[model samples]
Target: MDFLENVVSKERTLNPEERVGEALRQAGVSITITSITDVFAFAIGATTRVPVLRSFCIYTTAGIFIVYVLTLIFMVPILSLDERRRDSGREGCLCLRLPADYKKNRCSQKLLLEVIFRRIFGPLLVKTPVKVVVVLLTMGLLGLNCWGLSGLKNDFDRTWFFNPGYQRDFVSAVQDLFPESGYRADFYLGNTDYFREKEALEELFNRLSALPGIKNGSIEFWHHSFLEYLKEKKGKPIRIMNVSTKAMQLTLTRRPPPMWICKQADILLNSVPPVGAMNHPGKISPGLQYMCANG
Candidate 1:
């Protein structure tokens, strides 16, 4: 309005409506489509592993929508005051091409975009056989992609963040030497009274035993073996040193060495007690040696 009134046509001034129409005819649609492409790029990039792009996309989308709505509402009036003669017979002139003779078949950017985006998809949507084939191909591709994704396992190797060969080889060597390997889970009892809450603990143990992915014989509780030992002790007195040990000593060097010294020697040597006819609890005591104290 300012240009037309002051500079271009001082005598015959152009109205606001005429100016808006002229602006739209010149570059509005092209600008709108370019903005749409930008928004699409932002949206798709947001879906990928890019946080800054996602934030920019969100702000850009909101800003674009707000300005677009405000412009449409305020500037695009229904009534027209100017009578500018249009050459093209097209109704919705959103292609944003320059006004020219419609008879010429010369291709423009707008026509090329229309042909690729609209005309190409239009036949695929309307035609039955093409639509069916496209849908089947799409479904097959989706399924194959899902299957491939399912095969991707989560890898958290420490070497991934460090120098690959050196750190990885060092770890592998350590594992090979002192190969301490086991699956263990710890449960904090806090200040709970274990004797008073035996039933709850038993229930918890049963639940843990029933859990999936737990090896059949892997679950171990201190109380389980302790209770079994108590049960066996209650049945009969457990012989600390059997007659065979004394007999073997008599056969070799008699005099019957002190029981305390014998026990210390046996423990230091990690002596495996022979399985006798009497099912003694001493045989199972080695497995009961745990790092965590039940009390």
Candidate 2:
């Protein structure tokens, strides 16, 4: 639209081809700069870790690039054709030849808004008093925006991205019913010797549980179930006790020493069972055995 306006504003003495060439010469730098700026700005979004945002950015960047290319390739010829149509006194789209008087009158007349801006508003805006007022108002807005930034809370609501469907309704219902449990963060432990670092792992879990906004008994580590199984089988209370070398050997061999351990392993591998009736089932538990096996 801006490119077409630039072409149309060229001297009436110039032909359509000359006007197009002149418009490109005058507006090319600005067009290129703005398009490049927008492309780079959206390209930055591609670096985000969120899959949806990253994909959006990637597609938007490509789209902007393609549109920019198309504009350069096609707009000049289209603008030249429109300019010829205007010069021939033909109505746009309809291609009807307009009356000579009407064409002349239209060509000579200026738009009321353009006239008002040029003669009144534009001149008034340049005056010292109005300029000072404008600067003050702009600064006031800037200050308010900066103050508002301090109160901005960073949050992600997955429901906002969902369309109107069963998935969206289900998520909305869950969020309404259990606001605290709606959003969660998963922590992964990799390549650690759980037998040796059991205490450290427990301390880490306890600290995570103690953090503000973490629901009580919400932390689920498969090691907890393994500990329970050991306590029951060995007929003793257990807290941070490293398993015996024989038990460790059994674990390494995938035998687990007992049918009960195998049953517990199946449960651990499938999902992290709830700690108690009050707690929600842990959805993020990748079993210790799975992690160790992969690592």
Candidate 3:
């Protein structure tokens, strides 16, 4: 082992791991090379069995499949950047960013491959070009996947969640009657006696909500987005309004509807504390719940 290490370690520019890899070549035996994508794919695929791994399956089959694929289209640039770095013969950004003494910097992908071969040694297959080709092919396949995703029949109608059957039909009929009136906002009104009385809360909540980026506000002339007020409303009457964007049936045809001007969006109620109960809106954080309940 020292003989091999001594042979490889003599290379001035090659990283230590790269040196070890060269030593392995002298010894013979190859292993398969893994790329960033392979790492991610395995990382994602493994998540199915290991619940912890699933945290990385960002590419879920949600809402619009085609759009999701299109979104993953961004992976192309990232992979390309990796390829460019590998070809330039410079250490990766990670290596450069690390403090000079970081061992991992010297243990580059190539060097690591060699070291593995020296230990378990089989001829290490899959080189830089192969990895790049694999990544490009995968991205292309993913792009084509967008077509199938786009074909998915998604009911993006605004009325469905709250009003189900007749509400859907009513919304459909309304669309026929006035295609321009498709936009709607939902305000989950929590009946708190506070807003009507707390002048400061009312004024602050109202003024900010009217501001852009804020979907809803509590009081008129106050600038508070509906989300901002969510934490503040603690057991108080809260009004959360959901705003609609242009993607609705017709952009200009719809406008933000005042409560009286339009039928308000549905009311979501939280009858219990946010954790543990079936009626709770948020999932129970078992870890936090344990610490809080027992501690």
Q: Pick the candidate with the highest TM-score.
A: 2
Off by over 4 Å in 3: 1-143, 146-155, 159-164, 186-188, 194-196, 204-295
Clash count of each predicted structure? 0, 0, 22
Off by over 4 Å in 1: 1-112, 118-182, 210-212, 236-295
How accurate locally, in lDDT, is each candidate? 0.48, 0.67, 0.40
Best by lDDT: 2
TM-score of 3: 0.23
Clashes of 1: 0
User: What tens digits encode model 1's per-residue C-alpha lDDT throughout 35-111?
Assistant: 77777776666564344556777787777777777656764553232223222233334534454554545453245
lDDT of 2 by residue, 11-104 (tens): 7678888888888888888989999999999999888777888899999999999999999889768888888898888988798999867735
Compared with the true structure, the alpha-carbon lDDT of candidate 2 equals 0.67
On residues 202-282, what C-alpha lDDT tens digit does candidate 3 reach at each position? 454444344453333222221132223333434455443221222211211233223312222221223322221112111
Residue-level error in angstroms, candidate 3, position 49: 26
Write down the worst ten-residue block by lDDT for model 3.
284-293
Residue 199 in candidate 3 has what lDDT? 48
lDDT of model 1 at residue 69?
Answer: 72
lDDT of 3: 0.40
